[model samples]
Target: MSFFDRFKNPKTAEEKKRIRQERLLLILSGVLLGISFPPFPFPFSLLAFVAFIPFLLVIERRETLLTLNKATYLMSFVFSLITLYWVGSWQPESDPFLMAGGIALLLAYPCVMLIASTLYYLSGKIFPKKINLWFFPVYWVLTEYLLTLTDIHFPWILLGHGQVKFLAFIQAADIIGTFGLSLVVFYINVFLYKAFSNYKNNNRYSVNYLVAGVSIFLLFVVYGLIRISSIELPNRKVRVGLIQPDINPWKKWGTGSLDKMVDDYLSLSQQAVDSGAQIIFWPETALPVYLMGGNYQNEVDKIYSFLEKNKVTLLSGMPDIQYYFNKEDAPADAKFNKSTNSYYTAYNALIELTPGTRNYKRYGKMKLVPLGEHVPFSEEFSFLADIFKWGVGLGGWNIGKDTLVFKVPVENNLGKDTISVSGLICFESVFPIFVAAFVQRGAEFIAVVTNDSWYGNSSGPYQHKDFAILRAVENRRSVVRAANGGISCIINPLGEIEAETKMFTKDVLVGDVVLNKEKTFYTEHPKIVTAIISIFSLWVVGINILLFIKKKFDL
Candidate 1:
């Protein structure tokens, strides 16, 4: 039977009514989830609590595995579509119909959701009735952790991210990471669903589960309050200048005047320096050309000269190319050019140019944006690139291997010391584990340089900025975000937005970011939570397989 046959071939009026009700509930869940995100409709993040309740109700009502799977997919797809419509809007000129990008977005969010939902349903089938709810939350978190392991990672819409504005509630991320918060959210929805169902059936409500759920939530809030009150900004401070050039990325890509763009950035850097800025940060692709690719040495030297004359360190995003005589020596993902007769690797990198130093420290971006910066599975099927290519000259960038940290000299009232900095380019800021690894490697603070102009004036920029807050709270590190368009801001360790710029505006933001060497529980033991969950997931699978064997063989 075709996929749509179920809708058309309803045998009874009750079945038709049930299908209509399920569709409505699923869509409601999606909208509620979307509005719960940052830059919310009215800043009511508590909507997230009840957002999944409708979907849970639909799942409970499912009579078959197929129905449960369909309901889950519908809920997830609608939620992803509503909240992440900007995914399709990115680089529309390159993908006029938004097919390639749209399909990629579908795979990133909805398809992942389908997998999570399927796992959830399967886990429920394997577990006993009373303990099934617990399994779903754990399995959901496992699914989220699994996303981090893949190349096409989109950790943007994690449940903890929705609560970033509630600084007093989400500080627990420092201990257990964002997955812990997601676990809490799922438990709450399950509790509410149980309560509502019991009331409908005139049965005694599960007060024990309710108390346990409420206690967990209260603990998160109380722990957050204590942690927030105890956080101390380090004495050593770095006055960082964030430049939002407000250049339209599409237009910037097409423009020929590379010198003009470089001058624009330098002029802004000078403005920041005039205001006592010690370190200047420019957005991703601010130079638009490979600085070390040997073609733009003069322009690269011009920026270097400005940094030298002002005695300020500049951290800017630029394309970097490394040529290899042997293709075997290049990275596994490196692209080979037949015309050049050499294999080379390209990176979306953050370069640190300091005064009186010819050798600059370069940190290549590890998490390349799928379909936008790097095409997935291109190595296996190179023709997939021509089919999925969009945006002028965007795609097929090689991934970076190292978690490079740069040291910057700064002074405080106490004394002077070099601060270790972790520079995250573009979407790398969204990954909790990725940022924590840098902190574990002794990065005092985090700097995020991005080109969000591709998202235009949509909620994409706002949503992107919110992730920085979670990263700050999770790692207890100050985040300095410099976006090409707007939403540039400085986020303190407590998940507070100290300063920010409006979207689509040319602006310079200068703020003091405290340099701290303290590592939080999350940074020191990054994958502890996920690791524990993985072991339990394996145990669950093992038990299920053993039970199936026993039942099949009458053992």
Candidate 2:
């Protein structure tokens, strides 16, 4: 029968029953995947290993590309909605635009997932039946990698991230990175799905496939155990303090006076200092205003004074601005200021303020949150910036150009020494390779500053904190995260949480973080795994297209 014939005719009872089963299975797959995400607890994440089996079963039954993609969209749609429902900050005090953006993301993410399913369908058309099912992982990995390159990129739900709770299973990330873990997960799903299908058909090789899948999983577990048991962190440690002020996101922007906020942060830092903190870190936008914009000299002086008195370094997130009188000297996307008759750009930036030196280092945030920070493709379609801005004035920020590794000098009882650390401003921590670049450059440890209060006490904040575990494991670097309104914590090189702060509380955490001078295999060769998978995905597409050309022209 033709593909359209079944739809054109009335459905039979058996066919209707089969359709119902497929729908239920797809929904189950999505739910399993969603609940398997981080902050859900440990054994829950184990479901990720088998989450795709039901989805794959549906794919196997669908013969046409349209049917296959429709199933793909349905399953991924449920998955996206369940896991990313918190993106919009759907709270009474949340901005309407922020909520709207969140809804839009849930709707659009399924479409992005469809890219992989559609490519997999296309590959099945060219490859032999036995060889086609294995291409799903390559296509999915390629899609995830490609998302990192786009303007509206959000690789938030990369499959490997789900396995963070399985500490022993993920220690391999140091060598393969998250992408490799994702590959392992996908292949295991494929093997298990194949085994189940064969068993139902009474095939003899069912047990072989099941054993292969289980064996591969245990192999990684054993490797993780060995790495964790034998791994040695450096003796060199830096005593650091993280401050969570529990500030309300809405009030801090316009209503709160800059001086009062600075004072509050200083008071919190004083507490951390009293605990013997050599260096203090505050959450993102600790100072919402431009501290060095020449208008807030008093506030700047007060911060420097505190730094000098306490004999410590203060690193915090602040809004930074740059001005250009000549149009040629400004970037093409620089904003125009009519009052000043100049082009100026604003940044969501980080600054380092040390006690005795007036010279401070700054790093503008590079990986911006789309719609939340800046509109994607706003460079060409600048009007989108004005239309899609967040209600709290966080919607339009210029992308930073340079990657900076801050050199912090601290004095201990032994002597005065300098250490290098990478500062990730909010959403930048989610990018594995991006974080690795800082380690490759010279950063001995990772410090993240963020304000997740906009999302309130939702899964967004918790999930955001857990991703730091992967970064820590992948680079073998200790991570210190300071968040406004909670979940501030420190993670060691082994992906273990050393110290943590609860959500929605004003708190201070102090911990000694290890400083590693050596780079991990993943850090040194960040792109190797993803690059290889991308090439194979390209070959799949290239081969499929060539076969189509040959069949169409009889060549």
Candidate 3:
């Protein structure tokens, strides 16, 4: 039968009614999931608690595995389309064919959600009796955790991220990370589903399920309240300056005057320094040109001299190049220029220019945006680069191997103290564990440099900033974000925005940021929760495999 024929006419009247009900339920779940994210009118975060219940009900009632898979994929695809449609707004003028942007907005997240849903369904089937309701949360958490380990890592619509605006309930992230929040939300959905299912069949609800769900949710709220109240700002404060240049990403490389851009940055830096800013920050690729390249020596000298004269350290994002003697000696994924016959690696780096020193410390960006910065698995499948090269004009970049931290001298009331700053370049701020790793390695404050101009005035920048707040709460470190075209702000350890800038504005924000060194439970043991879930998931998969073999062979 054709694809539509199966859904167009059912075998019986009862089957037709069942299919209609299933469609409504799946659509309801998808809409609920979508509105839970930012840019939606209301922050109805409560919807997240029961968003997946409809899908769960659909899965449980499915007569065939193929039907279940198709239903799950449709639900997930709808959810992805609603929440991540802003991705399609990225450089549409450049991508007339919409191939690259389409993959990002339409294809990527749906595929991820489909994989997650499949695992969840499989886990349910494997432990039908013992783990009917419990497996969903575990499988979902495992799926999110594994996404972090991949090259095309996009954890934007993680269930926990939906609760960012509801700060009071998400403080548990400081201890357990966002995966824990996902577990909490999914468990509540499972409990509610069970309670309602029991009520439908027996005309009575399961008191245990209701109690468990309510109690766990209340526990998170209580913990959040206590945690927010307990946090005290550190005594040592660093006066940091953030510059938002509002450069148009499309014309930034070719059309705009390079000299004029540098002058604008210098003017802003001077304004920030005059306001008694101890350390100044610039957005990602603020310099526009490769600072390390020979062409920009005069511009580099100007910046260095300004830093030396003001006695203030300047941390700016710029493009960097590292040339290799031999193509084989370069990183496995390093791009080669056929024209230059040179092997080189390009980086979106944070350069720290200290007073009285030409020698600058650099932190190369590690977690790159999949197609924007580097195509995934381009090294293994070289043709993928040509296929996915539409949006940014730049090809795949070499991944940075080290987690480097810079020590900036901050003069506080007590004496001169040093604040260890960790750099998160552009999309790197979205990863929870990646930021936590820097904190564990002696980073006192996190600095994010990004250029969100490509997103325009869409929900993309807002969502990006929301992820940074979670990172701050997770690691209990203050975040200083510098975005090229807006939303630059300083977020406190309690997930509060201390200072901010509007989108598409050239502005300078100077704020007193508390330099904190104390690490949270999450920082000390970042992957402990994920490790436990992964181990259990593997065991469940093993059991499922054995059960399948036994049933197939008639054992």
Candidate 4:
């Protein structure tokens, strides 16, 4: 029968009722997961623990993988729409290409989710035992981790991100990372589903499942409390200033705005320096033009003059260009400049300038925002670049090859030393593994520079700010975030926000952030944790496939 024919008419009243209940359960699961995210109040995140139970119950009654996947896809779509609706920047000035990308993500993310459900369904069919449900966490977490490894990656809805408001509960991120938290949440939901199923069947053992689920939760909370209490932040500190210029992101790229933009940054840096700030941070793309690309020498001199006058180090996110004079030095994909007869590329990058240091340190942003910053598989299908260009000219940034740490000299009443810091530009902050890589490389603190103004007064900025909290906890390093329109703040090693600015406001946040040279267990051994999880996921799926082959082929 055709896929649509199955839904045309139910043969009996009981079947119709079951179908209606399944649809409601799927929607319920989606709504629970959606409202649990940021921009909602605290305690809402608790809903995430039980969110998957309803969906699992629906999966239990479905016999065919096709029907089960279809149900899972709709549930995922509802969740994605709620969490990622602001990605397209649906304003009057928004680029059509940007909007198109956003819509595509909402549609495609659900299809990606089908991988986990299919695994679960097949495992259950092969195992023919209730024990198969216990592997759901592994299947789900593997999918979340796999999403982080690709160019079209968007790990925005990782289950652990929902617990950002519950600080004490998330302290364990230092040891396990966000993906581990996802595993824990998924297990709890599976147990709860088991308890509910057993209770409906009048089994007294339902209490055991309930107790098992609650016990894991309580154990995690106890561990979190102990961890949060035992955390002793480093004594060394640096007073950093975050400049939120509140510039209209769309208008800044137009003609005659470069001078004013630089002036605004200098003016804000002066305020921070006057307040005794040793380091000043500017938001992403602070200078829309290439300030160091030979043509903007005058602007470069102005920035240098201000840094020298204040004796303060300035780290800002901006567009960086590199021209390869030698043909052999250029990558095959490098754009050719006909006027100069040279090959070059542009990057969304962070540059650090210190007083008396003519050579600035720079780190190009590695994780590009899918279609907004780059086209996925552009290298394999080169024509994609021609069709996916954004009107604002930010659609084609070359990926950065290296992760760099900035070394800044600091001096105060007690002593002087060079602090090692790593900068994450824009969406690079979302990947847990990516953030921890910098910590493993000896970064004492983390700096994030972003332009959240494009989305404007939405949950995107708020959610972006909160994700930094997990990074702080995971790496046990302070996170200092500077955004164009606000939510600029400092997050300590314990995932606490020290100071923050309001959205769409032009302001400066000056706060003392700790400099910690220590790395967390998660930072040191992320591979081990993810490897074990991946092994279990693959082991179960591999067994299921082998079993099916043996049964069908009589091998």
RMSD to true structure for each model, in Å: 2.5, 1.5, 2.4, 1.6
C-alpha-based local distance difference test score of model 2: 0.90
Per-residue lDDT of 369 in model 1: 83
lDDT of 4 by residue, 320-375 (tens): 99999999999876877899999998889899988886898778888998889998
lDDT of 2 at 468: 89
Which stretches in model 4 have alpha-carbon errors above 4 Å? 1-7, 544-554
- Minimal lDDT window, size 10, model 4: 410-419
lDDT tens digits by residue: candidate 3, 267-314? 999999898899999999886677776478878778887888889998
- List candidate 2 stretches off by more than 4 Å: 1-10, 551-554
Lowest summed lDDT window (length 10), candidate 1: 91-100
TM-score against truth, every candidate: 0.94, 0.97, 0.94, 0.97
Extract clashing residue pairs from model 4. Answer: none
* Cα TM-score of candidate 1: 0.94
- Evaluate residue 300 in candidate 1 and report its C-alpha lDDT on the 0 to 100 scale: 76
Best prediction by lDDT? 2
lDDT of 1: 0.81
Quote model 2's TM-score. 0.97
